[model samples]
Target: MKVLLYAEATRLISKSGIGTAYRHQIEALSRVGVDFTQDWEDVYDIAHVNTVGPGAKNVVRHCKNKGIPVIWHVHTTPEDIKNSFVFSNFYAKLSRRSLTRKYAQADHLIFPTQYTESVIRRHGVKVPGTVISNGVDTQIFRQNLCKAREFRERFSLNGPIVLGVGFPFKRKGIQDFVEVASKMKDVTFIWFGAKILALLPKDIRRILRDPPQNMIFPGFIPQEELIGAYSAADIFFFPSYEENEGIVVLEALSCECPVVVRDIPVYKGWLENGVNCLKGRSNDEFEQIIRTLLKDRDLSEKIATNGRMVALERDLSVIGDSLLKTYEAVLGRCRS
Candidate 1:
């Protein structure tokens, strides 16, 4: 069956998680051998809308009116929108209202994680939803010695390197990351992301100006370079307060980099603490975990091996099969 993969604001979100997620959908669909198109006017049997912009609302309406099944991928919820930009929290209520109305128009909903599904339900979304991982490309994101060396040489990263991905935002626990890095002057902390400087709040802008000597903000780097960063990092420290499902975490796991994340609800069922990854409640705990991982190579290797297995389970091929099944089921119900 043919499918329409649609996402609005492609250029604007090209550097964001939502953009990465949409690309993953394309990869997953291709692996499953599904015929799909991004052309808005292209005739298709099903529509998988990945964004909630005004353009997407019109697309959903058009699809529903034509009796075509619409799968609305819930990548953004009001809960995770706060602390992203100036007055981000102030716009959350409006975002909720808009999101709920658009989501209600879909024939079905797709969430990147079960936690995302639960949150959308709480926001008054009555539509049936399914949880599918954003998935990772194990082949591309896996560890590579050549790339690792390149990353270190390019960035001049010395000693044990700690890496963090995603834009610096308060909700992402950027403040906490800075504080943690400040306390650990011996280990180099590198954050790879690019955010619009003017859109940032005063506090975030202020901190970015005078970050500790050990900290490096390389802005955004190419995907090839990012793979190297993952390979070279001793630990992937993600202190984000919330996430639907972190694509970067999956990439780190695939690279067999031991991950330390905040004890957030989104990772409840998966990301077992001390097994595949470490979980910390605060900056102090995060620092302690990083220190332990640095000293205990055995423990680091154990978790790294386990984390790779977890990533394998969410590989693009596996995600492709699951997505194909879901698409067929939705179409089958429509036929009946």
Candidate 2:
């Protein structure tokens, strides 16, 4: 079946999880022999809209009017939007109402996590939806010793490295990351992600300007280099307050890097504390987890190994099959 994969503002979200998800979806759908098009004008059997912007809403409306099946992908919610960037919190309430209206136009909905689906339901989005992860390309994110060594040398990094990857936003737990780094002055703390200087909040901007001695903000490295960073790091620490689904955690797992993430609902079934990953409830807990992982090589290796297995289960190939099935099911309902 032909599918129109639509996501407004692709360039704007290119460095974001949404953009990465779109790219991975396109690759996976193609591999599974699903004919798809990004062009709005192209004739297609279904519309898989990923964003809820003006253009996206128009597409959803157009598809409904044309009797075409529309699958809306839920990548954001009001709960996750607050404190994400400048003015995000201010606009979050309105976004919820807007999102509810837009999602209502879909024939079916897709959520990256069950927790996200629950959030939407709480916000009064009653549309039928299912949970599906934004899978990672294991080959691209897996360990690369050569690249890792080169990356460490290029950045002059020494000693154990704790890393995080995401945009420099307050909701991403940037302040907490900095606080953790200050306590662990012996280890190198590198954050690889975009830094939108103009849009940063005052407190975040101040912290960026006068970062801790051990903290390194290598803003926006290439994907290959990012993969290397994951391989080089002894531990991947993500203290984000929220996420629809933390794709970077999966990528770090693919690289066999032991991950320590905030104990959030989104990662309920995805990450198991003390099994595939370590979950921290606060900055103190995060620091303690990092220290434990640093001192215990066997535990780190065991977690990394198990994490890789988890990553494999959510590989692009597996996700593609799930997407195909979901599409067929949606179409069947439409016909009925």
Candidate 3:
């Protein structure tokens, strides 16, 4: 079938989750020889608009006018706005509410994870959407990465490394990470994303105690460098208070890195608790959980194997098929 993907927000700074997701999905479809177009030159049977904000709304409306089935990929909600330091509160709220309406009216509403689906159902909208989890490039984050050890040494680490990515601040649960890291003095913690740096001024940064001696601050690195970083990380410690569904988690899991995620339905169910990840509710919980994984090499390796297997099963190739199925189903529904 013919499809036109309007990835309007792909221009954001590198490592931006939404932009990365859009770009990767577009590439995934192309790799598999899906007959899709980015521009509007050819008439498309379906128009998948990635994102929920104003930009996507316009594209959805245009497709609706042309009688093409529109797929609205709702990645975030109003709660995300409250929790996001990367995007200003005013903009997120405005975008969330409007996007909700646009999504509710679209031919199909698709979410990256079941957690997002569950929350939106409570908002009193009867939208027909499926929980299609986002996928990762398995080749880059796989257990077979040749540079794993070399990359670790390059990052100046021979010890267990705790990697934290995405925006910083209360929303991302970095504050909790700081509090937790201060107690467990063994593993090294590192952060990325320029937006995280921009969140805290020099004065605010000074107050936070310097992390463990094992810790290192290797400023923001480009997306291309993330494979090396993932290869080196001993654990992907994500304390995000609200992640629509962390793409990084998939990336890390693909690299066979065990994850310690907060008590969120998406990660909790999507990933087998204690099998692929350690699920927790608070800073103390996460700290203890990390401690368990760190001490148990057998457990860590087992979980890592499970994580890579999960990534292989849920690779972009698989996720793309689900997306197309939704598109075809929606198209048939529209035709009838």
Candidate 4:
């Protein structure tokens, strides 16, 4: 069936997780051979709205008036937005009320993770919802020795590389990553994303100003380069405080790179510490995990293999069927 897939501020967020998710949705729909359009004015069967911006609210209302079923994908919640950007906590306070009203307008809601679904539910969003992952395209993100070698040479990077991907937001644990990097001076640490200097808080700006000699903030890279980076990294050390579903994590896992993430509620059921990947609560814990994986070849290989399997399950090809079903179910309910 035909669908209208829309996301506001695509240019602004194209390097962020939300934009990655929007791209994944488009890829997933296309893989399932579902006809879709990005334009809101286009004639379509359903409207799948990804952003919570003013234009998004307008699109949802327009769809509703036309009796078109609208799927609101909850990419950002009030709690997740609090520690991000300058004055973000204040924005979060305003967003709670705004999100509650905007979310209520949808025919159904789509959450990237169960943790996110629960968070919005606590905010009193009673709209029926389903947990659908922001899946990865395994074909593009898989392991590649040639690309990995090229990435290291291009960046002038050496062995035992530790990598983190995403914007330098406080909520993403950039401070913690830097602190952990400081403790490990021998190994090279690279963070592959950037944010406007003016938008970041003073503390974050200060840290970025004088990062450890071993640590490198190379700013955002293209997807092809990112896939190479993931393939080259020895450990995908993401110390994020919160995430609906981290697309970078999936990309790392898909590349068969072992990961070390913070012990957060968002990874509760899926990420078991010492199983598919390691989890740390503090900088000390994160540093220790990285050292262990670096020295212990068996442990690293096991986690990498297991993590790749996990990514395969959430691959775009598999996720496409789920999206097709969800779309059909929503349309069927509307018909009944």
Candidate 5:
């Protein structure tokens, strides 16, 4: 069946996790031979909108009026948006009310994680919902020895590397990353993502300007380069306070890199503290976990191997099959 897939501010979201998710979903759908269009005006069986913006709301309204089933992919909520960037907390307050109204227009709602589904439900979203991971392309993100070597030589990196991928935002635990870096001078910490320095809060800007010597901000690298970074790194450390689903974690896991993430509820079933990956609830715990991983090769390898298995389970091919089922289920419900 043909579908209309729309995401508002696609250009602006290209550097964000939401953009990566949208691209992965599109790729998965195509792999399953699902006919879809990005054009809002295109005639289709389903309208899958990925944002809660005015344009997306309008599309949902139009689809509802036309007797078309609409799938609203919930990518962001007010809680996750708070403290993300300058003045985001203020916008988050307004976003909560706006999301409630927009979500009501959907025939079905899709959440990347069960935690997100609960969050939306708590916000009074009464629509039927399901959880589906925004899966990873394992082929593109897998380990490559040659690319890893190239990345090390290009950056003149030495010692065990610790990598974090995402925009430099406060809610992403940028401050905690920097603090951890200061205590570990021997380790090279690289944060691979884009950030608008001017738009960041003054305190955050100050820290970014005079970051720890061990910390390197390689703003927005290409996919090939990113895969190399993931492969080359000894540990992937993500301390982000919020996430619908940490897609980059899956990418790192796909590359067979052991990860240490903040002990957040979003990773409840997806990540285990000592099974697939380590979890740290504080700066001290994070530092200790990283050190333990660096010193113990066996433990690191074991976790990395398990993590890769988890990634494989959520690979795009599998996700494609699940998505098709969800779509077909939605269509069946519409018919009934």
Candidate 6:
């Protein structure tokens, strides 16, 4: 099928999960040899969009004018707007609401998670939508590409490493991540996140400005180098307060790294605590669990093995078929 996929920023090609998802979806279609473009004369059969802003809005208008099918992939929620955009700019939530109306008007709705579907549903903007969990390149990430000792020396990493990923923002519960790092004395805490300087409160900004001796912040790493980062860590730690299916969790699992994720509903569905992954709800629990996992190498390895198995079966090629089915369903509905 012909598709015109539009996104907010292709910069996500180098950083962050939403950008990563956009890149993956386009790549998946490209691998299957689908036609897509901006212009209408050579016209697209479907126009797939991501975030609800200038690009998505403009793409939808163009596609609708040409009588082509349109799909709005809802990757961000209302809460993300409050956290990422200031009051002045967050007025786009109103525009975002209008975009949800576009979803209601579109030939189809594409969402990364059911949680996202539920959010838009609650907003009284109901239309046909399907859930496609974010994807991972399982085969590429499963192997250990970097030698541990030399890699550790290059980055000056010391002790059992605990990694904190996702953008550094309040919604990511970064303060909670910092609290976890502060409590753990022996482990070196590492953060690979975006620089959200303007959004943070003053003290939180200063505390993270220099970062502590124990805390390591690698500003931004491209998608190509992320596997090396995962290979370097003993466990991937994420405690996001708000996540519509954390794709980084899948990426970490793809690397055969054990994970400690928040006990959020979306994560709870895929990750079985203490069996396939470790999960926590409270700060005390998050700390104790991290310490216990650090000491238990055998348990961690077993969990990592299970997590890799899960990522392969759930997040890779299997998801491609599921996505295809969703597209087919949308097309079928449109025919009626």
- Off-target runs (Cα >4 Å) in candidate 2 are none
Per-residue lDDT of 1-336 in model 2, one digit per residue for the tens? 899999999999899999999999998898799999998778999999988788897888788788899999999788888997789898997887888877877889999989989988987878888888999998788999998999899999879999999988888999999999999989999988888988889999898888999999878999988888999999999999989988999999999999999998988977899999999998999999999999999999999999999999989999999999999999999999
* Candidate 6, pairs of clashing residues: none
Candidate 6 error regions (>4 Å): 12-14, 38-42, 85-96, 145-147
Report the poorest 10 consecutive residues by lDDT, candidate 2: 96-105
**lDDT (10s digit) by residue, model 5, range 198-289:** 77899888987888999998788999999999999999999999988989899999999999999999999889989999999999999999
Candidate topping lDDT = 1
User: What C-alpha lDDT, on a 0 to 100 scale, does residue 315 get in candidate 6?
Assistant: 54
* Candidate 4 C-alpha lDDT tens digits along 129-159: 8899999998899999998999999979876
Local distance difference test, candidate 3: 0.75
Across 1-336, the per-residue lDDT of candidate 6 in tens digits comes to 766767765664346676878767766665555566644345566667776666667777877787777777777666555554245236546656675566776777877777778777887876778888778878777647564455577788767888878777666777778788888777888888777667666655775776667788776766656677788788899988778778888888988888998887676467899888999987889999988888899999988999998788655566667766676677677767
- State the displacement of the C-alpha of residue 307, model 1, in Å, after optimal TM-score superposition: 0.6
**Global CA lDDT computed for model 4:** 0.91
- List the candidates' TM-scores in order: 0.98, 0.99, 0.89, 0.98, 0.98, 0.90
User: Which 10 consecutive residues of model 6 have the lowest summed lDDT?
Assistant: 80-89
Candidate 5 lDDT for residue 99: 86
Off by over 4 Å in 5: none
lDDT of 1: 0.92
Q: Tell me which of candidates 1 and 6 scores higher on TM-score.
A: 1
**lDDT per model vs. reference:** 0.92, 0.91, 0.75, 0.91, 0.91, 0.74
Tens digit of lDDT per residue, candidate 1, span 39-73?
86889999999988888988888887888999999
